[model samples]
Target: MSKALQEDSKARVKVLGSLLHTADISNPMKPWDICAYLADRCLEEFFAQGDQEKELGIPVQMLNDREKVNRCTSQVGFIEFVITPLAEQMVIIFPTLSFLTRNLSLNVELWAELWKNSFDPPTEDYEKLMARVNKVVSRCRAAGPWEEEAPMRQSSAQSLLSGSESVVTEH
Candidate 1:
């Protein structure tokens, strides 16, 4: 009788697995709009976790806590400590994958810029400024109804920086 094959445990297999895992978590390495979309999804998940933890009377984790978590700060921490380090090491391991680190670096700069200009409140009284920035970002990211059926196109970070939404036409 034939038996099922076991999973590969070779060194190369392990390295490839690690690279694949990094790629899965490398949304920040994508263009700015895609990163924003992914960040929105991540926040939704974190909020859900926080809600469940609160309902269960368990202590909420910082990232999962909607009230305590500042998205910009948390994202900076995540990219700097988590994504950048991993991508840098991955590039060393696989030189052809250096683009991963490059994109991560660019994204770090973008996030830092956004945080400094918009998300970072100057003082306790600056909450309104942050809210306004968030509203503008939300509006820019809003998708039209046809977006669901259309092939997604990646938008450059420059477009986001410029705060211009390009008109789309149905072909």
Candidate 2:
């Protein structure tokens, strides 16, 4: 049986199992515009957990309450503490999935650049970055998914910083 076989309680198998997750690794391989829209919807859902908890007089858990949470800080911490480590372990377990972590690192950079008090209004740079994310997302969604990868473009963080959707296409 495969080491990853379910319910095989060997310590080694259990250790390997712990590394697995169905996490959305920063929407890699998806159209960026669609990914961004999905990300926004996901954010709304995640933060709403806090609002619901508060109404019930329950202590909101980490990442549950948006009013009390700092999106930037929460984002970086989640990436650094949770996603990055899990992704790294999974990469070791399945090296081909290293692709999952590439754009994830870029998102960490974006969030880190946007880091500020959650209560403070967004900075010009933060707003600009978000606009760029939405613009790329909108374009991709309108165009629909691609059959082939955009071979020439670097990471979106680079494109976001440069303000160009420099995805190369064959003419």
Candidate 3:
């Protein structure tokens, strides 16, 4: 058990415990592919719940509504808004657990890329989507604290843009 998880604060015990138990550090060795699979399964459960809710004449949870949900973007929001912040705060309390935040950060980046690609796709292609996912998965670095941290790459609009792509658009 992580030292952070073991210590429970009275004022924030409920939330703190929830975040600690669900954070990446709780299952550090979990494979990325398995994580994606589990997320898909969880979404199915949510969709089922929404269906049941509709049958019962109740309002469905916003994201749980199968018709409106975008798997990639919803996941990105959850990880970015909830999980990453929790993991990052935990890292501050336990510097040794910094790797947890690094893993989470990369996960958010992956989801963002997926969202950017499929945000408004008029047509879906399973083979192409899987190829993109696999390519992104291939480039993911393992969350190993022992590995040397790579230097951050610097980029600006001038360096990144060459074609008709504009960083900002006029309304």
Please, what is the whole-model Cα lDDT of each candidate in the order they appear? 0.58, 0.50, 0.51
Candidate 1: count the clashes: 0
Winning candidate number (lDDT): 1
Evaluated at residue 40, the lDDT of candidate 1 is 68
Of the two candidates 1 and 3, the one with more favorable lDDT, higher being better, is 1
Cα deviation of 14 in candidate 2 (Å)? 4.4
User: What TM-score, over all chains together, does every model reach?
Assistant: 0.65, 0.52, 0.56
Most TM-score-accurate candidate = 1
**Where's the lowest-lDDT run of ten residues in candidate 3?**
151-160
Which ranges of candidate 2 are over 4 A from the true structure? 1-20, 23-39, 116-155, 158-171
- Cα error, candidate 1, residue 35 (Å): 1.5
Count clashing residue pairs per candidate: 0, 2, 0
Model 1: what TM-score?
Answer: 0.65
Alpha-carbon runs more than 4 Å astray in model 3: 1-20, 23-31, 119-171
RMSD (Å) of each candidate, 1 decimal: 12.5, 11.3, 11.8
* Candidate 3, 1-171: lDDT as tens digits: 455546756635765675557554332223334445566677788989999999999999996788888776666556645565456556555567655655554444444444454344434543454454443333232222423432321122122232222211210
Native RMSD of candidate 1 (Å): 12.5
